[model samples]
Target chain A: MQHYRRTEIIVGAFMLTGILAIGLLALQLGKVGGLGEKGYEITATFGDAGGVRNGGDVMLAGVVIGRIKRVTLVKSLKAKLTLEINNGIQLTTDAIASIRTKGIIGERYVRVSQGADEQFLQPGDEFDDTESAINIEDLISKYIFSSGSN
Target chain B: MNGVLNLFGFMGRGLLRTTERIGDGTMLCSRAIGHLFTPPWLGRQLVIQLYAIGFGSLIIIAITGAFTGMVLALQGYYTLAKFGSESLLGSAVALSIIRELGPVLGALMMTGRAGSSITAEIGIMRVTEQLDALEMMAVNPVRQVILPRIIATLIALPLLIAIFDVVGLGAGYLVGVNLLGVNAGAYIGETIAKVTMHDLLTGWVKSAVFGLLIGCICTFLGYRAVPTTEGVAQATTRAVVTASVSILIADYIITSFFL
Candidate 1:
């Protein structure tokens, strides 16, 4: 009976440790997009969103204030990104939402630059001034061609 | 014509035998799971088995996870450095461990450590007529014996895999940041940013399936072992091999759908 009790205690400890490990992974290591949070949705259209993925970061002044909610290719053959920005931050109408890469050859994120306009954009608003991701391949080809012609 | 006929017959028999074993294994799993609902809960037996299987295997899993993470960092650093992107090492190590190695290696290690023991124990029971003794005593041998082992394995494996992943990531951070000169902020940030609920779910699902596979394959081989010491040894070997291979095959199938 004592041996059985000891076994049960050890097993219980093992189970608790496992649960703690799982909790750490899910809470600390895993990323959850802005869902069921105090957030507003805003759309930004870009010519080429490139590597911008859903759940990608939305940075304002180098701080992540939100997440990229979704990425869809609209009928215009352009990428349409829906960003979920936190409640406190406000974006002016002329604010630019641009697809920017981290370092070189890193994951892409949306960077929203503040504008001079005093008027704040409401939820479901679309950014008129959006910049597409810079295609490295295209830049390389252009550089090679221009330099060769010279 | 006779030689060709013999070859065809041998192939057909082998195929049929394989199919028959699969069918028997499925039936055994269903019965064991069914017993889970119909109680006499066997809680004591389950705790005992959980200790034997899960707690016993923890050391091996941790060692494997730590080394795997360290090696991943070492290899990833050198490879990614060639492209001048050593910053991506954190993401590389975390992604590989979380998505692929964590569950698979955890399951494979469990199969070797616990699964072989499970087969041997049951095989010994058969050899000593203990299963028959249980039958004569009006206790269903399958219910009394197999059910708890399967249930314990199913409950244990996912938790072990979770532990494995955490230990591995910690080892990876230690290597990438402390040993090598990768930026700690970028390493951790990329890992946190790139890994989503989807990747975590993928690992959990794979681990659970592997748990089920290990439980069923080990128990089935033991239950069907010939009543001899040599037979028990062979069953133990076969159980480990089969469970390991099945985990890999199932991993590929599950990953295909998730991808």
Candidate 2:
């Protein structure tokens, strides 16, 4: 009986440790996505979003500082994405946000390679200069058709 | 005429026996589960069985999960590298582990390690008339012996899968970043963006069903095994084989529902 109780204690501790580890990993993986975390919103307008998805990461210098909150269509030919960024990081008024793919054929996310400007952008200010994700299928078809025409 | 008649009779007997066993097993599971929800939950037995089943198997689970993850990264890197998309290895590993391998492989490990043991232990008790002794004492043997084990498996299997997922991700990360030279940012970021709660929940639900299947099948086989040493050994083997096969089949059915 005593041995059983000891096993119980050990097992309880083991399970608790495992649960804590999973929780930490889940959060670190950013599955929570700023549900209750403090962040500021910045909207960026793009000529196209292609495969840029909502809840995707907004990265600066290979590090994630925010997530895409929403992707909306304005003027039927362009996309506007609402990005939720952490409070401490400041974006310059002339910063550029571009939709970038994770790999050759992977999900698209927004990367801000150079956001360093003398004048800083505010919460509601939009980053007008943006690059959209290149759809491989579209590019291939366009090439095939143009090559055939020539 | 006698030879042909004997062959036909043998075939008929085999069919009848198969149906009989299936019916008896169904009744055994129903009665055990029907009694499971009642009071007098054997708290001590549950704790003991939980330790025996869960804690006793952590090392094997860790090894299995880590090796599986490492192999996935190695293979996925080579395949994705053809397209210069090796950085997607993280998302690929995470999705595969969370959605398919984690629960299925974890349950298979349990079937081999714990399911066989449960069948043999209960079979030995039956052979020794220990279960009969409890019956004479007016104690519900099913509740005492089976319910706790069922509850233990139900709780332990999902958590085991969760641990498998975490260990798998870590192993994949180590292999991808250190050995394969995939960019670390793309690996982690794509996995976070792709895998969601829905995938995790599907795996958990499958684990629960697998737990119930393993727990009931092992206990029922042991309780009904022929009371002999050879009988107990055969029962143990059968328990493992049956539990493993059923887990795979159930996984397919559940995946179909999700699709």
Candidate 3:
């Protein structure tokens, strides 16, 4: 009976420890851009989202300031991306939204080019100047063939 | 002519014996599954097995996980920095550990730790006539001996994999952020942002299947031990080898299917 009790206690303790560890990790993940807190929302329409995925970072001047909240098709050929920008950073009405690659063959992220216009973008405003990410493989293939033609 | 025929006959008998052993092992696994759900469940036995398999194995798993993470971070930093793309470090380390390393390595470690011990204990019991004694007493040995180990293994393996994932990721962070002076917040943030539910779910699923394989193989090998101490020792060794090979093969199959 004592041996059985000891076994139960040990198993309980081990399971409790595992649960606690996972819980702590989940909490940490939730705090930083996972749950999308304290960020202003904006929209961008693009001919293609390219390889952009939800949870990809939104960057300004090479610094991550927010994340892609959701992606949906606003038209048959146009995709709409909802971005949650970090608070305290205001964007102009003329700000350009472009998809950029971090490294060669790396994942894609949204890059917001700040505009010089004095007018601040209101909530739910959409950026008109958007650039889809350039596919390097496609570019390389095109370059090789096009250069041969020339 | 007679000697040549005898040689062919010997080869055929050997093949037949091997096939018979495999069939018997399969039948044993099926019956063990049936016995697992039937009445008079051995909760106490299962709890003891769980402690032995789970709690006792934590320190080794943690150490191995941490070392693996540190190495991944170090190597990843060197490789990515060469291309001036060190920011992808988090995705590389987290995806590799969570998707592949954590489940497979943790299962292999448990195969060495818990798998060998379970096989030896049951093999010894078989040689000592304890199994026969239980059968004579009308107590189902499968229910008494096999079920607890199987249940404990299935429950314990997932927990072990989870521990490996968490410890390994933490180690990667320590090496990448503190030791190497990468931005701590960004490194962790990227990992969390990139890791999806599918990545974690796939690992846990693999762990569960590996657990079943280890338990069934070990128990089956042990229960069929020959009636001698030497035979019991041989069966125990065979159990570990067979379980390890099956884990590697199954991992490949699972990866191909999922990936």
Candidate 4:
């Protein structure tokens, strides 16, 4: 009887540990970040969004405050990004949203530079200033041609 | 001549035996599954089996996970450093462990540990005529004996895989960030960023399927053993080998669909 009880207790502990492990994976390590329904939406357009993927980070001063919700091509043949920013972080009308790569060949993300304007952009409002991703090949070719010409 | 004809007859019998065995195994799996939800819940039997399978195998699974993660981090650092992207080591370790090694290696280890024992236990019962006695009493041996084991394995294995993944990622963190001097935030952040819910779901599904394979194959092999000591030994051996090979084949097929 004692052995049976011990087995039940041990099994219960094992099951608990397993459940905790799964919860850690789903909640902490997974990308189902709590920004699902609580964030404010804003739009940013760029000539080239580069490899900025959906659910990519939106960083402000190197801190993530939002995620890229969607990426679509506008009628202007440019990229339009829908961003879901956290509720408390406010963006001004003059804030500059730019597509930037993390490392040399790392993932692409949006970096927002805060502007000094007093007016704050509302939900669904567009960022007036947007910078497209830098093409490293274009920069290298231009540098080589200019140096050769010189 | 008569020699050639005898050889052809042997080969034909072998092919027929293989096909018959496959059909019996499939029927065993379906009947056990059907018996799983019927009356006489056998909750105590399930708890005992869970303890035997899940708690019994925890240490070995965790140790395997740790070493696999540590080695993966070391190798990943060596390769990714060549490209100056050593920061991706965490994601490398996490993805490999969560997506493949956690399920495959854990299932393989469980087959050797719990699975072989399951086959051996049932085989011993058969050798002693215990299963036949139960059948004589009008009790379905498949329901009385096999159902608890299959249900316990199905419930225990995915939990074991979850524990394996967690332990593996922790060990990888120790090797990658603390030992290898990779930036701590990047190591952790990249792991969190790169591993999505979809990846977790894939791991869960794979582990569950592997669990089913192990339960059915091991139990079926033991339930149908020749009721002799030597036959029981052979059945145990065959159970481990067949379950391990089936897991690999199923992993490839499941991964193809996911990809």
Candidate 3 residue-wise lDDT, B1-259, digit = tens: 9999999999999999979988998898888778766687687788888898889889888998999899999999999888876776887788888889998899999999999899999998988889989999999898889888988888888888888888999899899988887787778778877777667767878889999999989998999878688888898899889989898898898888887
Worst 10 residues of 3 chain B by lDDT: B195-204
Q: Taking the candidates in order, what DockQ does each have?
A: 0.61, 0.34, 0.42, 0.58
What docking grade does candidate 3 earn?
acceptable
**How much does each candidate deviate at the interface, measured as C-alpha RMSD after superposition?**
2.1, 2.8, 3.0, 1.8
Tens-digit per-residue lDDT, B35-55, candidate 4: 767787778878888999899
Docking class of 2: acceptable
Model 2 vs. true fold: TM? 0.81
Query: What's model 1's TM-score?
Result: 0.92
Ranking the candidates on TM-score from highest down gives 1, 4, 3, 2
Clashes within 3 Å, all models in order? 0, 0, 0, 0
Candidate with top DockQ is 1
DockQ comparison, 1 vs 3, better candidate: 1
Model 1 interface DockQ: 0.61
Worst 10 residues of 2 chain A by lDDT: A28-37
Identify the runs in model 4 with alpha carbons over 4 angstroms from their true place. A31-38, A73-76, A139-150, B1-16
Judging by TM-score, tell me the better candidate of 1 and 4: 1
Pairs of colliding residues, candidate 3: none
| Winner by TM-score | 1
Error of 3 at B250 (Å): 1.8
